[model samples]
Target: MSLLQSQVPGNLRLRSIDGTERLVGYSPPTRQNHGVAAVVGFEEQELLRDIKRALLRGVLIVGGGSLLALGMTLLVARRFIAAPTDALLQAARRWRAGDLAARAPGAARHSEFGQLAGAFNRMAVALQQREEELRHHAQLLEDRVADRTQALREANARLEAEILERRNTQTALLQAQKLQAVGQLAGGIAHDFNNVLQAVLGGVALIAKRAGDPAAVARLTGMVEEAAQRGQSITRRLLAFSRREELRADRLDVGALLVGLREVLAATLGAAIRVEVEAPPALPPVFADRGQLETVLVNLATNARDAMEKGGRLTLLAEPVTVAAGDPGGLATGDYIRVTVADTGAGMDAETLARAGEPFFTTKPVGRGTGLGLAMARSFAEGSGGRMTIASKPGCGTRITLWLPAMAVAAEPAAPVPAPRPGALPARCARVLLVDDEPVVREVLATQLADAGYKVTEAGDGAAALALLAGGLACDILVSDLAMEGIDGVTLIREARRARPALPAILVTGYAGDAAALAVGQRVEGSFTLLRKPVTGAQLADQVAALLGWRETV
Candidate 1:
């Protein structure tokens, strides 16, 4: 049993024929029921126990080492992952709160978490920069919009102002054109009419002188004088319209002017036109040229007569008026004399009314009417510190109002005025020299001087007069036509004065140019005077008598 036991590895169990547990040691059966139970060798039990203890101790040591390794791994994970994760969470929180600058800490920059943190910071910086740029762009757009809006508003205002100014300028231009046309027409009429008037007056004077019966002579003289006066009035109107008449501002009653104009219209406008004058007795007098005002009235009346081709009533009204500042006529604020001429005739339309005062803008067809009447009237009014207004409607006739500055006092009279009776010869017969380009004018004038009992010498031209004077023809007074084909009257007078330095000369002229020349001549160191053409015998005789210091023997 010992040798077998020695060969066996460790503790062993063996079962005999009897089914009983047994160790591999030699053991006797106890006397207890023939079933044997034996304690194995104590040493074997001890050895088995030792082997189990050693295996349990080694398992405990391995479990302790695994626990230590797990702890170390956890610590490393916390240091790298957990710490970065916490930082990232903080950055995310800050970013969500609109802090784009928030980023993971840079202390772990070498790790993946650090790399993620760096990327996040870069994105945040880019986003921040982009946001600022967008804000700046939005601000710029807002400012640009504001600037454009203001510029557009200013442009609109300027356009409106320019439009208004253009409209006013157009109106002024139209009115100016009308006045220019009228002045030309008037000047031409005056120039041509003067010649015809001269012939008529001379023929009438000759007829009156040759009358046989005393009653017949007086009647013929009266009729001829009336006609001559009417002709003179017409010429005055033409000159006034042309602005050729001198500015003779004087205080005059509008009523008297209207009365005289009524008679003129009666003769010229014919019986077809009915004229009415309605002026208050105590109307304020206007300071203006009397003849010009009369011309204004006559022109307006004639225009009215023309307007009413079918004959209509023309009313003239004069009244005192107050002109306030900002009045439509642009007159200074003060009291004014208002003269209105309302005509019952074909009225003007809106367009015509607006341009009524424009020169040469005649409503009538060519050759039928001249457009200058109203324009001249307005010009005269304006020249005299006043204005004109016209109110007209189609089919309703027209009303023209003239506002003239009121006069505070009547005009003072001259120191003294000499009165000479017409057709009176001088006390002393004076030798007179007459020169004219017209044969008929020279013939009638010489005849008139002869009737006045003055020896008269005749010359056809200025040269002839100069020749006569140079030839020692003595004369107290020299009368010459201002304009001639040869040497002009001014030159003849200048030449004649050398021979007769004390010569008293009278210049006869139908042209305004001649009048101007005569004015220049009068300024020279000699006695010189001017006479308008269509000279009546009486005017010629009176002028001659005055120059010679002749007086009528009472």
Candidate 2:
């Protein structure tokens, strides 16, 4: 007890019985023992050894449990977090490389990682759906773009064609306007010029009959007749150009006409140009206006000559052709006499050829060409129930073709009987009334009728002639100029016929308009005879005698 209390108050260090150091603690005296102390002692080394062994055991158990728990956690993380994340990464990489079908694995697991993977898969599905929709829309857009592009191309082509057609129509309209202007000018000129020619022709005829020297009469009359004929030709051309000339359709011997035109063309084309005509002897006849045909041929020849400035060959050829229905040339389906005028000369280019038939469209220098040649030729051909076509190229020479309807059976033309001369008139005198606006024209015509053994009555105008007729002037025949100041010949004839329904009247006109007017006014058939002026004395006498039923006896 004394030893236990020797050092510390409650704790003591001693050598234990096993020869190890010990540590002890003592309690104070208890009441039950009346001063006895309670001691609690242990071997310090053994206690420390037990605590160390327990600590070692606890450490081993805890460490093993911790390792097991760590392994389980690692397994859970790999399956739930890392594995799903790796799968999503792989799927993402594939998706990034344009694989919209790629999806993450482990979506069936009920863990958070499974939920995360599910959401990622849903997002990927949505993205893929969106991508598919975008792809489909893109394809549709491409197709629509292609269709629109094609439509635009077609519309552009149609627009271009319409523009070209409109341009051609405008060109035709411009040509028509020019032709109208030219026609108006030609018509006015022809009216005045024809009156002058009528006076000259009538005066020449009178002078020729009165001349004493036969040789002088023949020579002077021949010159005057020739001059009058030239003037008449000029007027006819003017009327034809104005489209005012009445066409006289007749059966023509085309081959003979072509042969006759050879020398005339040679002289007209000059020595430099060579003209060749080729027409079969048995070529079919064409029913057309003879003067118009001749004029067209002359115009074509002139054009060919002009084209061959450096001297080239011109060929006029004729052949029979059969036109079919719906022909491109708009010709009637029938047998036709085809005439071609070809020239080996400077040819027209595409643009010039297109406008070849347009009025006032010329490639020639000013004053050298009227530009009406082709236009007039085309008009004549059409008017004659034919068609004209031009074929040419830049280097290749031109070929202008005319297709005239061929007569199936042509009758031989009757020989023109000579008009009875004034000396050969019947002894029975017929009363005549001649009316004219011009004093010179009236006096000359009155002299002609008097010389033909007819009692002549003259009036200065249609009104005077009507006044005379109304005053009961006995007239077996009435001849009047168509165009007059107050009452026109048509009106005078109409009034005169009312009084003498059996009276035969002759209407002479220089202007085509007056002839048309007379035609419109005359309703009765065979009521009148129309003579174109410059009527000869012999012609007037024959007509007067014919009206009176007086034929010259042999």
Candidate 3:
């Protein structure tokens, strides 16, 4: 191997005896062909070196061709595929970031890639335009909804104002009718009251003249009492007719109420009118103010009497009825007591019947009627949760029917305990507190109490009465007028009761109807009894004795 290494110029070979191979190797100095020939046979080493050289040359040629092809392929891809694809990627990123104007720069290339970029830009533009259209439509719709809501609000406000105006007008007309009715009754009330006063004055004069004759004085006194009672009756009827107040509802048997009003109807209508009542015993009870019902009957009877100048028959018929929906009178579907007052007289025309319940609308001659009778009666019926309907025709009779709500459960008010006899009442030594606003009324009441043998204390107004009570003046009975300058009788009693919890009170008032008609009764606190004004001496004495639980000395 060492000999060959010194002698060889390229790949070396060595031959041994008998032509057997021994060594083969490579050397760096491959151009020394003579030394390789000396070490081995020339042809073999030379052939091997030639073969290696061919192999290296072939590898170099093939590698150079492959590198050139690869370079060409990369250049083509960068120009056609990579550049367009990169631009498309950049444009897509910008578009997603909401830049609608972003576009691939290679779009003008006039190839498939250019066409794709062009199509994508066109789609972006279409989407942007569609979004703008959607926004415009949404804005327009919102504006329309806002305008419609505003219009509805304005319409509702106008409707509410019109309703309020109609109600106010109705209230004013009713008030005007009430005033006119009161004015018409003024003349009649004065005439009747003057006659009663004359009788009373005559009786008193006779008693004064017959002072020494006990029987004559007693007889005259009786006449005076009768005259006073007649005056009270006239005033009561007047009050009932002219009362302008809310209804005080109570359970009442329609039959009993109609029967009780027969005498009043006869008196009001005179001898030319006959009143016939047909109320079945099985008629259901109703809820209404007793005084208001009486007033309604009287008004109808008066209207009937006026209609019949010569003579007429009035029939008051009552029965239970089940009203259905859409009834003729606009009554709600319910069980009701139907009270019909029919009169044989000059019937009303169609126009008159249509406007029957209108305030101050009357068919009678001017000044003969204020025209509030029918209107007020209808108003009362409605206020009591009922309705009044009129049926009439020309030359025929008129029937006014009142549909009143029947009481769900009929109840009887407990009767007031019987009062002690006047002679047996302890009129003497009972301390009394008398309160009134009017000087004359206060003086007269104080004198009457004093004369009744009671210890009387007087105050002119509710404030003075409260002050007296605050001063701790002990009182057995409190008699107070309702309307006063400061604190009213109701308030005074409430305050006074705080100090004397169980004090019995008698409230005297000209506003009896108003007090009774007030809806807020529970606010009054206690069961202080009410008495109407112009109370007689006997009535006053009896009330005071009863309140004190003291019987007069027999």
lDDT against the true structure, per candidate, is 0.76, 0.78, 0.78
Tens-digit lDDT track of model 2 for 1-48: 654344434777988777878898776665555766678888888779
Q: Model 3, 48-80: lDDT tens per residue?
A: 788999999999999999999999999999999
Residue pairs of candidate 3 with colliding backbone atoms: 424-551, 424-552, 425-551, 425-552, 426-551, 426-552
Off by over 4 Å in 2: 1-212, 247-283, 288-306, 310-336, 348-396, 410-428, 513-515, 520-526, 550-554
My TM-score estimates for the predictions, one after another, are 0.53, 0.52, 0.53
What lDDT is reached at residue 464 by model 2?
A: 84
Stretches off by above 4 angstroms in model 1 are: 1-211, 247-253, 256-272, 280-285, 289-310, 321-335, 345-383, 387-397, 411-414, 417-427, 517-523, 550-554
Root-mean-square deviation (CA) per prediction: 31.7, 30.1, 16.8
**Per-residue error at 276 for model 3, in Å?**
7.3
Please count the clashing residue pairs in each candidate, in the order shown.
4, 0, 6
Query: What digit string (tens of lDDT, one per residue) describes model 1 on residues 1-554?
Result: 54333422355566656655555644444445264544453344544788999999999999999999999999999997898899888988998898887766864568788788888888888988998899999999999999999999999999999988766654555555456435544554454456446655765776767777777666666766666666676666556545676657877888877876675465556567788888888777788887677767877877887799998889988988887889875789999988999988989998888888887677765444557689889999999998888999988999999989887765677887656567544534888889999999899989988898889999999888888877888777889888889788788888887776777788888764345445673545665888887788778888887766642332
